[model samples]
Target chain A: MSNILEVRGLKVMYGKSIAIHDINISVPEGGIVTLIGSNGAGKSTTLNACLGTVPATEGKILFAGEDITHASTAERVRRGLVLAPEGRHLFPYLSVQKNLLLGATQRSDKEGIQRDMEFCFELFPILKDRLKQKAGTMSGGQQQMLAIARGIMANPKLLCLDEPSLGLAPAVIDDIGNKIREINQSKGTSILLVEQNVHLAFGAASYCYTLQVGEMVAEGSVEEIRNNDVVKKAYFGG
Target chain B: MGVIPNIMVNALVLASMYILASLGFAFIFNMLGSVNLAHGAFYMLAAYITYYLCAKAGLNNWVAMLLAAIVLAAIGIVMERFVFRPFQTEFDRVVMVSVALMTMLQQLAVQVSGSQTISIPAYGNGVLDLGFMTLTNEKLITFLVGLILLIITLYIVYRTKLGMQMEAISQDRLGAALQGIQVNKVAMLVCGMGFALAAVAGAMMGAYQQVSSNMGDNINVRILMLVMLAGAGSMNGILITGFLMALLDSVCPIIWDSYTASAIACSAVVVLLLIRPKGFFGHEM
Candidate 1:
């Protein structure tokens, strides 16, 4: 009934440049919201601000009704606001198992972590086979899967993903799309996905917000956004 | 009976001390991405502190080493929080800070302890006549101490949660932060461990050799060579290279003289460095 995550008047500046201005977005409880935009859009900046990796010039970010604008990235993560990041950011030298375990670094619940790790293995059996293998040795698709599964391992209440399908085969992108839906349905986890792949985002997310430059150009249900003439021309190639 | 046995024993002792000194140096380097020049300063201070605690305060040798370790560990924590953390991102600032620390500590040792040589009282006395080869209790104890500490250090780095976190931080700081790891907290622990290892090595070496103001100078250069040969951010690399250096240090002096040994070792390092800049066990620089 209530929004699980909210960002209001989120303004981010980079030296002399205004990266994002007055960006307002929200993810309702158990809702899957997708933010779609082009290269120079402020999608990544929004995610980074929410994670507190980049300091916000002006804004308020709310997680479960609590303002976490000033919290550190670790603090934000501890409170179940996790980001998988754009590049997958795997510790390449470390084994796959170590990377997965690091996902729950702040959590002390041993039993819960054990259960979640098992769940991750079940979700990505490829990962189970490559426990000792270095993550860097994996293919692009496998690495992306690991990054997403790593986010799940954190047991996040609101998982903010930045470009889950940036550089992957079409089949792998489809698998990721299905997995996102499956995660949303099964785990009831609220997700804020940022994507350049409009089809994958539209297929997975029930709600959609279109970002152009630094501002939200459109926001509505997936069907409503699909039918919009401006969005169709800009994103869907009408 | 022969210098061969003594040489072998000396190599092991030297390897252990070098390993101990470099282990902390490697940890700090991995965590901070800086070449901790003040590590030698910390090592020198620990030797001096242990000297005062044992020789001046009339404490037992083992007790003095333990006290010195705790004190140095505390100092390391303070340095990490106040000194290293502030200039963590700025390489130039860290260098300035570290150079200031090294110069100050080196001077402090010269002024307080003077240039005079003072040896720690032996933990035990007399030689163990083990049939063929005789052994001094001082060398035997120092070797044992070094071996045990090396094992402990290996255990802490290779088989612990803290170690995993350390590796994670070294490889990817942002990724570790995203996982809710308290990076600063982990850095403090590592900084303390680094200080503790250096302190222990300083104490053991001071007991074996005589403590002088310039004791840290040779060791400082030795550690630099060890770390460089090991490459950046490679723990196992340091271990292998440390053994190789100890071998050179021990056998060369026996074959020629100490100065000749130093010259040979330096030459070998320079040649190998040009061939493989990243060191033996390291990845791309």
Candidate 2:
């Protein structure tokens, strides 16, 4: 499949410190591409740069064959590059329904939003039950579910998830993996997932990129990555 | 005037006025995460602007009040884009910027209107002798304006889409940006609303009490204290705390000297904060 999103030589900096350096990544039109790395591996920064939250100090980001390197975060989102950020960043004070509704902020299609809300309800039935409850009051697993569901509500062409299974039980992590597959297979949406859980990442993605210390060290299918000794030792614990 | 009736009227009037000013200050502080010392300047500047339009430019007091609100709101948009936006992340710089704004506006007010206290001739100078109490039209008008404005503020914050976005942004800037909320535009809108509220409060209170350049300086402290007591991200808390503080401001002077009354109020606030730590509705912004 043709690439829906591509980052070429992208470098991101935080003051004097560089977070991601000369990173090249892409999400094909219908594939799950996972960036598996440990904490402080510049994984989240790569996602932020693609979403335009962090400015790319160098190189270009092409979305759907259009140059979108210097776009505003909102513009990037509107153009369907949505990120369900790390930390499950829900508006803690707002009700769950409000949080879910806010996910479709850039869209004015009332019927479409309603349909998507129903879609979220179907995906996370707990969200429907806790519509009036504050988002922060929910359990961690449920909040992660809500975050992924909220990201889906944006009608994203490419959904980027940062640390989706960061602090969840094994069963919940399995559930997240299942949902990632469902999103890919059902919606035909390209995904760029950042994860510290190498096992979950390898299971969910067709292709994986191993990032270590602000650099892409490996890129291959799960079987191919298993054969790369350095990547296997560093990420797969081989 | 019956002593109790007079005090009650004073309390209500003062509470209403203080709420108008403090609500604006609190929202700006929460949304922008800035102390916004310049908020008081907007209040003082609005009074002078209205006063100028009425007294010098030959406009009706009511018309001038509307004009002042619009002008101040427009100025607020410019300020948010330039003065406040640059310092969004740096709290120290925001404080410094606001201080500079306050100084310049206060000087302008003093230069234009002098050191003496000024007043807008009451909205309709008449008293309603309701047997138990004497109430002037100015007192009633100020209270009504305050009440109506408070309602509008509540409605905007609770009912509108933009208000929802503001709350989201105030809660988590990164999360809101991820949701494509266009945070800068919302921040600018909030600043406009804040300046407009300050203008209305200043114009009304100028008629009620006095309009001096230095008037804003003292009231600014009162507004800040009210906000701190209310805590961040708690707009309703601001309204409640504002009323409580206004009652203290009005009632304490009757029982003791003004400074002693203020001391008691401050001490009580300190105790309450010690007990709860996060004000009444303390939530993170």
Candidate 3:
């Protein structure tokens, strides 16, 4: 499979402190690729850098072979590199339907947008029922679902999910993981998953990369990483 | 009865102008979470521009008002891009910038007009005699203009895609940006709209009252009170609070001391705050 997104020698700095250092990763088309790491391991920094939320001090980002290193965050989103963000940042005062509509802000194809919106509602039926409800009032799991649904509304070529299972109940996490897999398989959309939960990451992802202190320490197939001694000790607490 | 009608007309005129100014202030506040202390300065500058166009350039009063609104809107866009956008939401810097703007505009006005009050020629010269009272047609026109503008503003805010984007940004800036809404572009539009609205109100008030460098200071206080009383992001609340405050400003002087009207109005706002800090109809805290 051809790589849809490639990050080369990406570096990010927050003020004087370096957040991510010379990290490189590539996501191939139509599969789940996850970055597994501990808290503050710069998984979010890497994702932010790719999304153009945090400027990469020195690096190159190629989306579908088009360089987007200096693009604005909104421009990056318009070009289909969308990030769901770590906190599920939904517009709290807006209705669920409005929030979903906003996800398609860059697209002018009304019919296509409408179809994707219907697909989102179908995937998250609860969101359909609560279409007019304020996003803030939704439960954490429901909001997470809405966040993913909102991202899907963009009709993105590659969907970047930042810890969709964070703070979710185990069953809810399982449901989200299953839905994510369904999204990848059915929609044929590639995904870049960033997660601290190794089990969920390994189960949902075909390939995984382990990050430590702003650097990629290991990258291999899920099965390969699962069998690695260091992966077992660091991720599974074996 | 004649006195009562006169006071009622005055109340409506005051309320309309207050609503116009406060609505603009509230727009910037809602969209950017920026206090926009420079709003009063914008209002003052617009009034002077209207004065210069009509009085000095000999333009028609109505045409001058439109020109002033457009000019001020452009200026507001520039201000947002250069001044406000850079120091957004920084309390001290916003205050400093606003105070500096106010002083600079006031000094310019003083230098040009020599502290003399200027007034636009009245658009409507006659008065309408109702069965109960005599009312100036100018006051009636001002009230209707304000009402129409308010309706238009509401429609633009609630019914349009731009309105949806504004609401989205107000709710979550990062979320809006992630959705591809250009925050800076939206901020410029909002600032332009807000300043234009305030300018129109300033010109109308300048025609009805006398225009001076410091006229905006009084209106600015009233705008602040109206926004606070209505709660941020609540448009309808502004209309209701504006009328209520106008009623207080009108009726209180008849029953109580003239100075007590300001005190009473302020007390009402304070009491409302004590009861509900977010003001009535505001989204939950």
Error of 1 at B98 (Å): 1.5
| lDDT of each residue in B194-246, candidate 1, tens digit only | 89989998988888887777778778878999899988778888888888888
Tell me what TM-score chain B of candidate 1 gets against the true chain B.
0.95
- lDDT score, residue B163, model 3? 87
Model 3 over residues A1-238: C-alpha lDDT tens digits?
7888999999999999988898989999887899998888899999988988778999899999999999898888887888898899998878899899889878899999988888887788999899999999999999999999989888888899999999999999999999889989888989999999877888899999988888888889999998888777776667
lDDT by residue (tens digit), candidate 1, A128-204: 99999999889999999899988988999999889999889999999999988878887888999999998899999
- Worst 10-residue lDDT window, candidate 3 chain B: B276-285
Q: Cα deviation in Å at residue B77, candidate 2?
A: 1.9
Best by DockQ: 3
| lDDT of model 1, residue B200 | 90
Per-residue lDDT of model 2, residues B22-116, tens digit only? 87778778887878888888898888888888888989999999999999889889988987788888889888888988999899887877787
Which model is ahead, 1 or 3, in terms of lDDT?
Answer: 1
Off by over 4 Å in 3: A233-238, B2-8, B130-133, B255-258
| Inter-residue clash pairs, candidate 1 | none
